[model samples]
Target: MFEKVDPQYLLEGVDGFIQEEVSYNLFYLITGFEEALTIKSCDSKVLFAQSPRGNPWLWVNRDLPEEERENALKLLIEYLDETPLTGVSSEPRTAEMFANLYGARYHTSIKRRMDMEAYACPQVVKPEGVSGCLRSAQLGDVETVAQYLAGFSEDGYGIVVDPASQMEAAEIMVCKGGLYMWLVDDRPVSMAQIAHRSPRHGRINAVFTPRNERRKGYAGAVVSGLCSILLGEGLVPMLYADMVNPASNRAYQKIGFIQSGQISDIRFE
Candidate 1:
């Protein structure tokens, strides 16, 4: 059976796991979110969590016997009986199993929304011959950043978003001091963000370079520069890349990121 547990329970013996595995579980590190829910199997082989801002996430310890893993998932579905969930995210197989069982129970159809590969960079391999240097984004860069944000959404996920609609988000990101720009000859050519810092790793996201700037190595330069900053602070850099985007994956790999695991995003319709 799965029982509701305090989020801190996840940290027990976490040191034994590599940072890549721990990155997916960082949602549990979010504290004092009244809407958050966390649960674990009695044997502690399976974990499920949901934060207000995201879909429910499942983590099944691969070391567990297959039969035990199946039983735990069954109990999890039962525990969530009638609970409304729009979707789930997890390592591919776990997400598929949970989505199938949950969809059957609710009579809903499941669709795979995205397949993402988690990556970690232990050492940065900055691209040479890139003229741009990394600088923290400021309020003056909001307009440019907004456009880049909109472009990132459309290009990376095929989502149509207006640049004006992203203005507020751009301002917030810039003000947070995590947003960065790769400036060449005083012009911003690429952008990236240090989305969040977990205990041992920092996540980089929103990497984008305009079509006109593509193939110029700006994306690699920006991401590698951010990785160096994180490393200076004693934190490893990690990010999730869309499995369908070979270009972005190759870029990250060129900068020293190693594929760690895969996560599937499934939606119920």
Candidate 2:
């Protein structure tokens, strides 16, 4: 059995479970889900949370016995009958199990993803002649950030996203002091964002360097700088990377990130 609960309440109930494999959804739950929705199993062993009208993700406690997971999945299906869900992001086993039992057609096959965390700052080597410093992105950088965000989506995920929407998101990030950039002669060359942050953890994401800036070490420099700052704030830096992208994964590893575990991103058509 499951019961609908306020997201604020769910946050307290699942705090320990989310730490098992902290991800964007976790940060969003903590930092941005004031108006979101939540549900938990009657035993409080499983949780499902989502942004308003957005896709919901599952988070099951590792200690929850196998039988509990089975029962929770059934309850989750019944709950979904009333609340539409377009996707699920969770540990590979949990997400796959839910998708199969829910009869949600596999819209996109599961992709292998790595969850990584950094304990110490990485030693970064700046390319010769690439001189600049890292700084928080200002509101004036919206155009540049928006363009790079769109390019990143296309290049990194092979998905086309609306530039307007990207700009809106970039504006929010800049205002929140979440966006950072590497500039040369006052011109932005590479950028990264603190995607989701908790008091003890911060996730680096949306890393991008223009094609002309590629291989010049800007991406590495910006990410390394961000990780160092997050560490200074007493927060462990973490990030997620597609296992298919060796270069991206290698870049993060070079910044002292070690593989923690794997998760799955599945979309239902």
Candidate 3:
């Protein structure tokens, strides 16, 4: 039996942030409609020692608590040792640079060396009724969207899991994201997610529509509309599309998103 975790208390430690088990999956129940959680998290693959030194980042938030923050770094360091990771990435949780992930120093280093490439941001249109509208999603829309996403299996992107598992996971993403859904006449349609919100940039997650819903000008509108909102909010928008899909690449191109970098998925032992 699982005891419901208190958000305030569980966020007290690094393990809490890395492997937070909430009462009712608040992130999903709350976000309305999100891109769904499909990242390669060891969240379910491994168990944590109560006082483990290292942590993992399950959620990306600026207002992370003290216990969770410190522990998360410890967890990140530990996890790095176990997994064959290329990018020793970390987020700037604080000002002191106690443990630098991708802090000011690292950014400065990359800048000074001229190793990092410069890139422009993507801009999506805003959602509204009539032409292009983005409304908050409901529980009922979950099944439909979930079914549509199953088509994007690991066979293609090197990320695979049972479709049923994907649906269960998506529930959590929608809630934590305050997700917004696109609809037509009472029927749920396309979906987009908002994340990485900040002064520098905001990331867009899982912009998708059903296979049947494709070519109807839905995705173009959704991506554009969402990007527009982020731009309006003074945040540069970014996203990664499967390079394999020429159609998708074209869609983003139409919206003014330039090629950022070569994102690869390496699954090896």
Candidate 4:
């Protein structure tokens, strides 16, 4: 049976599993939004969270028998909704299974497959740039960061988001010293951010270089530098890249990131 649980209680129950797979679930659990909804089986074999922003996520123990997975998913569906979810994301196998069942019941489609990768700070070839340096984004850089974040959302996920909303998010990152920018001759050329860090895993995301700066290797430089800093702190750096974007996937690989696994972002339309 599935029952809703408090976030703290849920986190304690899944601590062991999440620490091992921290790269995947840290962002969802650490968002600090108390309204985030979590549900799991009585035996704690299956866990799901509906983020405060309405994103559904699932983590089912792979060791469970196939029949158990199906039953768990059925209970999740009943607790969440009888109708289709607007969007869902999870590991590739779970995503495919959930999408199949969701599509079987409603008119929905698989939106995208996001590949998650990790880097062990393997040697990186720093891009040839004599005038630029990576620096933490400051309050003065809020406007630029917001604009870049908006562009990133549009180009990466094809989602049009308000500049104000993006600014609000960027402000938080900047205040936390998590956002960084690559500056050339005192002008920002590219941006990246460290996000959702656990004790051992730190995620690099929101890597964006404006269209005019494309093909300049600024993004690679910024991300490589970020990885170096994260490694100095003794954390494994990881990030998600859109599978459809060959350039990004190639860029990240060149900087020593390897494909760890694939995940999916399914949208109901």
Give the Cα lDDT of each candidate: 0.83, 0.72, 0.47, 0.75
- What is the TM-score of candidate 1? 0.93
Measured against the true structure, the TM-scores of the candidates, in listed sequence, are 0.93, 0.83, 0.52, 0.82
Candidate 4 structure quality by residue, lDDT tens digits, 113-221: 5555433334555666535899999999998999898898899768988877888887888998888999998899999988767656678888999999988889999
Looking at model 3, how many pairs of residues clash? 22
Cα lDDT tens digits for candidate 1, 1-269: 67887766654554324543644845534433555777777666677778777688888887777777777888888888867888988888888888888877789887547999989999999898889788999899999999998998898778889999999999999998889999999999999999888778888989999999999999999999999999999998999999999999999999999888899989889
Clashes within 3 Å, all models in order? 0, 0, 22, 0
> Which tens-of-lDDT digit does each residue in 1-269 have in candidate 2?
78877766775656456556454335354336677767778776787877776657677877878887877887788766766667777777888788777654324443433322322233333334557889899989998898898888888768888777798877877898878999988999999988766656777888899888887778888888888787777777777777667787777776677676566767665
Ranking by lDDT: 1, 4, 2, 3
Q: At residue 157, what lDDT does model 2 achieve?
A: 68
Candidate number achieving the greatest lDDT relative to the actual structure: 1
**Could you tell me how far off, in angstroms, the CA of residue 250 lies in candidate 1 after the best superposition?**
0.8
**Candidate 4 — which residues are off by over 4 angstroms?**
11-23, 27-32, 82-84, 103-131, 159-172
Q: Point to the candidate with the largest TM-score.
A: 1
Alpha-carbon deviation at 154 in model 3, angstroms: 6.0
Error of 1 at 18 (Å): 4.5
lDDT value for model 4: 0.75
